[model samples]
Target: MRDLPTFDKTEIIRIVRRGYGIRVQKIIPYRHIYRLETNLGTLFFKPFHSKEAKLQLIVKAQEHLKKQGFTRFIPFIPTLNGKPYYCYKKQLFYLTRWIDGHPSNYDNPFELRKAVHLFARFHKAAKGFAPPIEIPDFLGKWPLMFKKRTLELKKCRKNAQKYPRPTPFENLFFKHIDYYIEQAEKAIELLDKTDYVLLSKAGKRELPFCHHDPAHHNILITSTNKAFLIDFDYLIRDLHLHDLASLIIRNGKASTWNLKRCEFLIKAYQEIKPITPEEFAVIHAFMTYPYDIWLLARARYIEKKPWPLTYYIKELIRKTKNEKARQYFLDKFLYSYLLL
Candidate 1:
């Protein structure tokens, strides 16, 4: 792993004290993070990846949430110069207070329900957020993107067919390519039937933003069962159902593709904010899509993940271990989806 910049101990301490005005007792490095044991407490310092203006937009948007009495977001600590970030040798860095919590347990029913409620509150609070300039707006991109992925899956199937010497992974991929491709196409077809294709308005009132990455790590649960969302880096103005679909996929995969668990998550979120019938239909399109298996194939065939053949085989098997239940889950969700 790469260390931080080649700054010595004195230079590092000087940088922190001058820019952030905090007296550091020790500087600890863990991978890409610099943990500052300061007089204030434990703080995390890291180099900001995006542009300064984008960071400003994030700060303003998050600060607005805080003003609206939403306390779930972790705000960026201002620099000594009243900026959310600092520039040293043309590299950007920022600091924030650390959360002393572990990753949320998907296996815990209580924590998972809390996570759903947290997501609902977050979406409701984000209703009035409107950035002045265009950022990473993902509204209306899903339908077209889904169409493209379907075609990409078809191309992978062809490539696998022509391999002079196919590996075990390729053979396994070829075996299931038809099933996943069929699901991808079905997802696209179902999306065409929804109101998602006709969405024209792009304002915050029409479509609220979603905390795009809802993986286990990004969500932290404290002893009080409070959920704290750490990273605002991937917030996008998209359908809130997109976020719910992601949560189901992230958690449902661990539950052996249990349909009842997915239903419970949806019901919990609806207790806070009811899902409209139209949004419910859109979510069905997202949930039934075989995104995980398609992504695994895309990584090996399209993106060319440079790993051993057996490694891909192992991951593919693990991802599809409960395939029989995946089909059942899909059928159960599809029954209600057709009634919609």
Candidate 2:
């Protein structure tokens, strides 16, 4: 919370009123979650690090969704000046209609199946909407991120040496990161060869109509068993596997999903849109992307990467607690993405 600013209910209400031209009786800000609530409804808001590029991308995503007739997405609100984005205290802000539905956690097979199906639909629908706006290159900092993370892992190891009976997870992570670095070149090659990639001639892969970050929490399930998606902040063109890989990795650690559940999702997704064989070949590498994020988080923690490092730590701990989660995810994701 210290890394970001806050807006009181009254403050948020004024912003909403001006942006949407609607009055609200109450406003509650969910700081950790990128959303603001008011009596009129829940209006999702994301504070851009005052980056105009990020703000414009969000506006573009909203407009793209609207044009495509995708109803399951959160709609954006215009600012007081009739602009899709606005600046407040040097931070860019955008509002969207708060979607009313319960967020699914994949506690059961049905929910897990539904989650995958919905994700597939999102991918299929997104491909149809050609965004005229150009997205700013945000993920291009990965090489630097990797270098910084290597240093942080060293610090973590150093910290562990001074402490008696250090955390079990830290030692395990030490092995994971070291092993990942050893195999980094292989992983990169696999990524390059994967059929799921939409690469351009310059060697940079085509960013899939990316959801940027698609965790279970960003998925919403309405009472009618319909799913809606939110949080377009991470929307950029990138690897498609990045989306499914992160979802499977995150959920597999927290809960165990049966093979049947996994199959259903993949089947449902294929029904809506198709997956390529090349993408199937690299399911293993995709599952490892979270590890990449962990390395970045470790690096950013020590170097102070100018973004919240706590989320990284949280995800790391999450995977650590479910030590075998990655293997299970690969098993299911590969089985689904490749076999069934």
Candidate 3:
């Protein structure tokens, strides 16, 4: 690992000891993580920086899950005053018992299946969790957001057309703009056909919490075949379909949009928590949105990051190549679930 920021050992030790009332014997650093060996047990200390209110809601959500007999999530070690986090020198920190596992390897089918299964369980356990703190709900705005992104892509296409001398990135974007626009339009059209508003309202009644970022990196698998979900930074009260879509999108992109792998993941998740037809429709709509392409457009046009334009153009080409396979997979899977 490259050089990481040096942390004050004495200060960390004091904080850990004060938080858990344990004696820290040693502190070992590993790639932005500090392992603390203490008389009580091995603990991992990581920097936590977020709005205090948001942090409180996360802690409450985890605690709620634990009470529901879901121990896969890493629980926050309370400070001396029973606070879930500690603030020192304008930095926030939290500790949790060290998990003896490695990041889930998506290449290993067994590991991938276990991760998907555990993710479904996590979503089930996360249901009915009412946060003590109030957080804004944006679940109802999904359609609006999808339409907005579609409009933005149209605007980008127009701007690309008007450029006096289009750069390579603009040229590549224009090349695929038609296909991308078609996808955005399809997403909006399908979204309009579905009762997404009603679904969102009904979903609010149950109030399922989603680990908005359920990528493979967040899943940990042990040698004994046990899986645990680690980070909850993006936890929010949204439909569980959001989490399912995220897993499929992340894994599908990595696997070049493999249809069988996508189906396997969906089946694995369904074995634990079955998805209704309405939910499946929303998932299809979510998958149809060209989120990756939109991000590339934003970075190249709006943000104007200094990264090489060719890199993103190449990515777009790769997506274009995989587009057929992705569509085939979506159609087959959606047909199996929704039609049959």
Candidate 4:
């Protein structure tokens, strides 16, 4: 790395000693994460980017998982004072013991199945969590969420137009933004047309929670074939089919969007915990949504997350360049699985 900022590393070292009572042997920065070597073991440190209330929910959810006999989740290592997080000058940080494993790659079929199995286990364990009064249930809000995100695409387009001399990313975005917007609208239309979603509204505890962002790096498969879930940042009381859709889409791309590969992954998950046809409809809607391109747009334009411009250009191309393969794949999956 380029020399880190003035206050970040120093403050982290100071907080680690004062709060966790551990002498940091070395600190390696991976984007926003800190991998530290300590006397106890290797651990990872990360700052809370969202509300402290969400952090509270995550801690409770993980505790709930443990009580339900779920052992694969990495726990948030507490401070010396037994607090889940350490506060220093208004910044909050937490730690977790690093697992000795490699990130699961979707390209590897065996590891993909293991990740799917562990994911199903996670969903099973996350069931029956009567969330605290403060934590919100998202079961009925998914339709509204789909609508909102679709509307956000219009706003993203307007923001892109405001650029006087549009960057390459913006130009590339303009080229395919309409197609993705159509995809988003298609998702909303599917959800609205599906009679199953009528039950999705005003339902209480009808759905299991999800690991919401179960990216490859978040799942680490060990030599023993055990998969550990690392990040607990976006846990929510949503349909676990959203998680299944995420798993399918990520791996679908690796399989060149092959329908058989997608079917196999879904089969692996069902062998552990079954998915209903209603859930399949919702998953179909989720797959219809252009999540990858939308993520890049929301980060670079909407949230203005300050990611490097080159990263934006490269990722946008990678996500949109193979549009034909992606669309054909979705059509095959829709006809085969969701046609009922």
Off by over 4 Å in 2: 13-21, 32-49, 88-91, 128-186, 192-207, 256-260, 288-297, 300-325, 328-340
Candidate 3: residue 96 Cα off by (Å):
0.5
lDDT, candidate 2, 257-311, per-residue tens:
4455445555666776675676557555555444643455355435545554455
Off by over 4 Å in 4: 1-14, 21-32, 35-37, 47-50, 154-178, 195-203, 295-315
Tally clashing residue pairs in candidate 2: 8
Q: What pairs collide in candidate 3? A: none
Tens digits of per-residue lDDT for model 3 on 86-188? Answer: 8877778888889888999877789999998888888888778777797656577788888898887887777678889887767667777788789989988
Better of 1 and 2 by lDDT: 1
TM-score of each: 0.91, 0.71, 0.91, 0.82
Candidate 1, 164-189: lDDT as tens digits: 99999888887787988888888988
Candidate 1 regions with alpha-carbon error over 4 angstroms: 1-11, 198-207, 336-340
lDDT (Cα, tens digit) per residue for candidate 4, span 1-340: 2343334667778889999999888888877888889888899888776678888888888898899899888888889999998887777789988777999987788988888999999888887777663665577676787788877887899899999999988888999999999999898888777654565542354545778887888889988888898788777777677688888888777777888889889899999999877777777877888878777888877999877899889999889877899999888877877785
lDDT of 1: 0.79
**How many collisions per candidate?**
0, 8, 0, 0
For each candidate in turn, give its C-alpha RMSD to the true structure in angstroms.
2.5, 5.3, 2.6, 3.7
Query: Which pairs of residues clash in candidate 2, taking residues 3 or more apart in a chain or in different chains?
Result: 42-98, 149-299, 195-278, 196-279, 198-206, 207-237, 207-238, 208-238
lDDT of 2: 0.59
* lDDT for 124 (candidate 2): 54
Predicted structure 3: lDDT = 0.82
- Ranking of models by lDDT: 4, 3, 1, 2
Candidate 4: residue pairs that collide = none
